[model samples]
Target chain A: MTTTNLPAAATREALGPTLVRLQQNGANIVVVDADLGKSTSARTFRDAFPERFFTFGVAEQNMISAAGGLATLGHTVIASTFAVFAEHAFDQLRMSVAQPKLNVKVVASHGGVSTGEDGASAQSVEDYALFSSLVNFTVCVPADVVEAEAMVAAAVATPGPWYIRTGRPKIPVIYTDGPRFQVGKADMLREGTDVTIVACGLLVERSLRAAEALEASGISARVLNMGTIRPLDVAALEAAAKDTGAIVVAEEHLTHSGLGAMCAQAIAATTQPVPMEFVGVQSRYGESATWDEVLEIMGLTADGVEAAARKVVARKR
Target chain B: MVYGAQSGHIGGSMSSTEILAVLYGRIMRHDPKRPGWVERDRFIMSKGHCTPVQYATLAESGYFPVDELSTFRKKGTRLQGHSVLGKPEGVENSAGALGMGLSFGLGIRLGMRLSNIDAHVYVLMGDGEQDEGQVWEAAMAASHHRVDRLVAIIDRNGIQNDDFTAATMRTEPLDEKYRAFGWEVRAGIDGHNLEAVEEALAWARDVRGKPALVIFDTVKGKGVSFMENNPNFHGAAPSAEQFARAMEELA
Candidate 1:
């Protein structure tokens, strides 16, 4: 049932419709919103299943905690809000949802500086780091609409705590058909041997583009879409490390605690400690700009990823 | 559990004794053998530090062997220092943080409505827990949804961890707050009086359109002489001599 007619759509834009489809199919889904349903697109679900929908009216903490409560009653609870706002409810998530490993899925939108003109406060550069740090959390950031929809379905099929981050701005669709998504598995978008570019979120698109650009310059780079950050595709990572001998991690988050750090840890734990370079926000906050402009400033560009890929490739042992 | 484990919350545990007794013994529709019974009612201890009261109640209610009380706070024991679901059974949800249980109970109430299970959810909280903003948030949401199947009980024991709840945070006019939030309020029931506790609960279970709040006024340490209304026993375990004296007083 995967479609080939692709459009440039925001990952968040896919949440409501996909959620509504799942609910119609008899998924015991209860969506708890914090008054930003229109923006997060939870409104689509509200329009469909008003009775099952709950709005906590800007109380993210209550929404998050109540999702835990509802999940205990055998409902697959999906709580939606902007990424930055979701961070404020980390304690509730830790105490109520994560500690108990409840069936609560926090599908946060407007992740990273891709939120554009909203500036520093609305952007979530630390979400993957924070959510993944929790013991039972499965943090995932899809590359496009198809993956976003599939990711939501996968989360419903699976249990325990899940944090799914989606971007506000519509980005290019990389997958023409939906790809099979396993929790800890990475998808190889492009095969190579010089180096492997491990990236997550919209950075997967950038990393793919970087690989294309790298091929023209005689540097053949492999591209891996690291959608699931926690319980990372260690086997794929190990294979990439063993195959290519170098890795470059790209993400729309902080360089310190996000994708770069996870890949580094994965590589470090193995005997193969490949040379790595990070293409992300340089431990600084993002500014107000167009989505593309802000991402460029934060070094989330294809060219930036290409440069890191080459740099790491050169340092191959 | 405090005396057995040598570490646990005793004051609030002692304070909530009769309330737990009334619910586990007479009220809640539960079978110790069928703790996960779909039709059974729920009890969530929001003031989670009071772990032993509910644990002991569950044991006496036949959820587990009464002798397992000795392993209350030990490592790898299902009887955690805070309330958690399963192991001994009958625990509906894991709760340790204050102000979370009511919202949890609200979810259960709403879910029960969706599934048409027709079971009540009772959330026990501390008076000091009213200071948590999430409590007020839950209070508003419960009334907004008008989930009559959810009953919130506040063990208004007057004292909290360091001192009295009045000394720490003045939660006066508590009934008015619940009323304004559209809850049917039954304030100031004598918590130690088992008959009074049952009467208030019997009334709360039948509330028609709004969620119910039954406030029980009790002392922090109800059964012992020196520990009564004493903040020092909020979490500290008694020495052997002090334990003997407390046992004597109870006898």
Candidate 2:
């Protein structure tokens, strides 16, 4: 997966059209939005299938509950809002959808500090943790437009509750043409022996850059695009830990309970436990800033991942 | 069931007993043997804590074997403290956290329209459950979308888990609020009167252009003389002596 000549696009750009295409194919899909359909790309679905699309006008709790209600009637409901806005609907998704294993897919955009200029309130750094905490939920953070499209189709094809966080900013394409993507699986983009760099969502592109930089500095760091956060690919993680002996986990979410915390727990639970460093936001709120500035502030970049990879490799005995 | 369970919400259960009876016994088109019948009308118990009356109605309606009623609230039993979907077969939606039924019913009504299935969705709520902001949110959306055949019934027993709605959170004047939200208001009906419940439900089914709200005025505990309008009976189950007295009074 080379960086140059690859098309870059925001992850949400794929959501609505993908659903529209699926609906054309006779898929039983319902799209629910909390008055942010245009911003979240759900407007495309709403326009394509006006009868199946519903808007709750800035009320996320009702939207989620209604989505769950629709799911009970044999429709695959996809509810959309900003990631931070989803905080109000946590218990609704948890009880009505997740607990009962309903066929409701909650897809949110504007994730992380990379959601630039929207400020701290809009940036959802804790969304991954909040969604993954729910039982019977397939939590996902797509790396790029292609992965996001596949996740939407996969979520519709599968029957159960799903939580997918798509990025707001455009990033470099990481996959080849029509690459095979699966939910609850990890994609090993690069192979290395010194250390493993695991990342998700928009962080995958930066991790690839960090791996490239580390290769130039004679430090071979493997890059893994871990899209599915829950039902995590523990086997791949354990194999990576066994092979590399050190790892660096990075994401656009907080290091406290998102990818960083999951990876740490995976490493500790694995037979081949290894030293690891995390490259993500700590326990702090983000402010109004550009993507690069927010990344710099939160230490979530190629340089930050590279530095963490180096530190982890050094710590390995 | 409440006397046997020793932990069921007897007050609210007794309050909504006749309403549930009139629904299952006369109004709803549900099949006990076929809980997933496509054309059947759906009932959502949004105020989930009052499961004793709900379970009794379902069991009495033949949704499941009546003998299983004794296992209420016990370990590994299908009868949970709160209503859960698929627990006993006829249960339509899972509920416990208040103020979710209307939105859920709206979703069902919308789905029915999409599928071209002419089925009604009835959501039974509580007076105290109105305090949850999601109820108003759902109310606004249901009427805005003109979701017909979506009916909401409030068990206006006045008491909550421990106190009254007027004292805790003050969700007073529910009829005006629902009317403003664009629902047909049918207020001040006796919930314990089986005929009134039947008439209100019949009126709600014909409500076109928008959703309908039926407010039932009732006592917290309707059967037992000692527990009637008594707030202490909200969550607390009756002791053996009190249960014996209640049985004699109902008999």
Q: Which candidate is the best by DockQ?
A: 2
Whole-model lDDT values for every prediction: 0.88, 0.90
Worst 10 residues of 2 chain B by lDDT: B161-170
Query: What tens digits encode model 2's per-residue C-alpha lDDT throughout A1-317?
Result: 66777788899888999999999999999999998998899999988889999989999999988998899889999999999998778899877887778999989998889887878998998998998899999999888899999999999999999989987888887775875578888999999999999999888988998999999999998999998999999988998998999999999988988998998998899777899898888998999888778888898888999999989999996
Encode model 2's per-residue lDDT on B1-251: one tens digit a residue.
Answer: 88888888999998999899998888888888888899999999999998998988898898888899999999889999998888978888889998888898899899999999998998999999999999999999998898999989999999887677788878879999999989999999999898999999889988988899899999998988999989899999899999999999999
Per-model interface RMSD values are 1.2, 0.7
Q: After superposing candidate 1, which stretches have Cα over 4 Å from the reference?
A: A1-6
Q: Which lDDT tens digits does candidate 1 get at residues B27-65?
A: 889888887789999998899899888888988989889
For every prediction, compared with the true complex, DockQ reads 0.66, 0.84
Q: How big is the positional error of residue A168 in model 1, measured in Å on the Cα after superposition? A: 0.4
Tell me how far the alpha carbon of residue A307 in candidate 1 is from the true structure, in angstroms, after superposition: 1.4
**TM-score between candidate 1 chain A and the true chain A:** 0.97
Model 1, residue A277: C-alpha shift (Å): 0.8
